[model samples]
Target: MELFAALERDDYEELLFCQDKASGLKAIIAIHDTTLGPALGGTRMWTYASEEEAIIDALRLAKGMTYKNAVSGLNLGGGKTVIIGDPKKDKNEAMFRAFGRYIQGLNGRYITAEDVGTTEEDMNIIYEETDYVTGTSPSYGSSGNPSPATAYGVYQGMKAAAKAAFGTDSLEGRTVAVQGVGNVAFSLCKHLYEEGAQLIVTDINKEAVRRTVETYGAKAVDPADIISVDCDIYAPCALGATINDDSLPLIKAKVIAGAANNQLKEPRHGDALHGLGIVYAPDYVINAGGVINIADELNGYNKERAYKQVAKIYDSITRVLEISRTSGLPSYAAADHLAQERISMLKNSRSTFLRDGHHTLSRRQLRG
Candidate 1:
């Protein structure tokens, strides 16, 4: 299980990988850091095209988690695990247990939670093998799915973006185009519709498209067509990197915010967006609501606390937009600056005694 590292910034650490010969389960776990505390993130199951691609995803996702947690004011570092196989076809009880074994081996240097392709039952199976997972069934006293909370966060963040772009902080009567109508997007569409935003939606799944159309009276468009619909907000909830060079030219939205994991084809794409005057809510910052929910389990699961944390998504998005405007940078670059600022502050605030581990700093000294 040896490999090369991906192109990385100076802020991360590569961790463990496990491949089960018996079940053909391949998982790469990337832990960015444990400086703040234990690295907390999610297990994403997908059919990656190549090992390189999988590694790249794990690395990028893990780094994003670090920023996401830090800027969101969580005392958790970032780690991410990616299982290389189609969750719909390649997943089984044994396969998940194998992954659970991988987490068990980490000894809580990293923790796993729910993500795009993983479900509560999958977490349950992982639970069977390791005590390193969360976001499970309600019987397990966990939030079964974070879609609604995630959607609520996005809705709040979108409202913030709307306020930044327009004077009003409401979605009512705004034209919002949603690129996917999955569980979270479904709730998002309902929220938008309830607020009287005209909804334009697209999905490869016909049943989902029909359902969204029925539920929210959204106009259905092809995925390719969804991006250029000239809406007030463009939400790409399906996948990442939809805002690359070729497609970025056609985007007409004033605000770009969604639940997708990795939206930039490359870091420069952020700059390209900035040049075009699009207000982007960097993927990780806006989508941290789910991770925030799962991480809340560590603190006795207070709904009020979760709500407060989720509300930060709005502030975070607004800050990114503000930075982008003032610095003449893309929202992604602005977010990176903000994250780096927070991390640097954390490092600076640690007293010399605390840094050396010979003496301890008071909480006041640690709060710098």
Candidate 2:
């Protein structure tokens, strides 16, 4: 890959390549932007097809963090680290410790958390080497599991999307079709159920489906039938790209809100949704509760503060919808605009402040 060109294209701030032969640690840390504050993102471990693939993934995920944090109103920038190895077989204390040292070298320009193929235990290992890490064990004052907080945020975002679609944000008596009854989705379903929303749930795991059905009195359906099911809202909590071409046409839901990442197969798909007048809560913005929860660790891990920030996702989604309505842009595009506007405002503010400071200093020197 043309590494410099790739970074330059996105105005990326920094990328670090760390290797430790002794522990077989091959990692790439990408810091996309730090205009907001220090970059904060997770450390993902994946067995990649090639080194180039790993680098590309790290860069992509890092830039995504920048947008996520910006839209979520977090005073942080975006960064990510990809460790190229088999998480199951290649993980060792030394490898994580070495990675932690590298993060420490950045002096908190980057903070690492647990991500795909990584666990809280791995985060604990990293904490041994530096304070620039989150998702550590609860014993370390880290927020334990992020699923419940994430679920609550999604529920709140869903209401915001519903308000944009329907006349009101109330989910009472509304039919909500939920795809994937996982940890986060289960909690989301509980919120929906308590609000008197009827649930139609589907999952590949029969046990999970049975559990949701029993717990929430939700009706179960085949996974293939989920997108086409008659419902007012479709909540995708499983995989990404469920909003692709095939599923888009089958969806009857007026509001699309979920905890999935990259719901739209592509950028154009988001435009398609806009054309259809479907209110979509952009995935990154709505699903940021997990990041918000972990980020609380930076300020000493106060649950109340973290959840309060997560609840703002409702306002964030509402802002995205308002921007779309006023600007005639797609919800996804509006989300991008929101993040860009925040970052640009800060950048411009700092530039003007510095320029004025220079002038004031020159005038003072002349008087002296």
Best by lDDT: 2
Model 1 lDDT, residue 283, Cα? 87
Estimate, for each residue in 46-76, the C-alpha lDDT of model 1 and write its tens digit: 9888988888788888888988888787888
For candidate 1, the 10 contiguous residues with the lowest summed lDDT are: 1-10
Full-model lDDT for every candidate = 0.84, 0.92
Q: Mark the 10 consecutive residues where model 2 has the least summed lDDT.
A: 358-367
TM-scores of all candidate predictions against the true structure: 0.93, 0.89
The runs of at least 3 residues in candidate 2 whose Cα sits more than 4 Å from the true structure, single-residue gaps closed, are 47-50, 86-90, 203-207, 358-368
**Model 2 agreement with the true structure over 1-368: per-residue lDDT tens digits:** 79899999999999899999999999999999999989999888989999998998899889889999998888999999999999989999999999999999998789988877788899988999999898888998899767788899999999999999997999999999999998889999999999999999999989999999999999999999999999999999886789988998898999999988778878999999999999999999999999999988877999998999999999999999999999999999999998999999999988998888743343236769
TM-score: model 1 vs. ground truth: 0.93
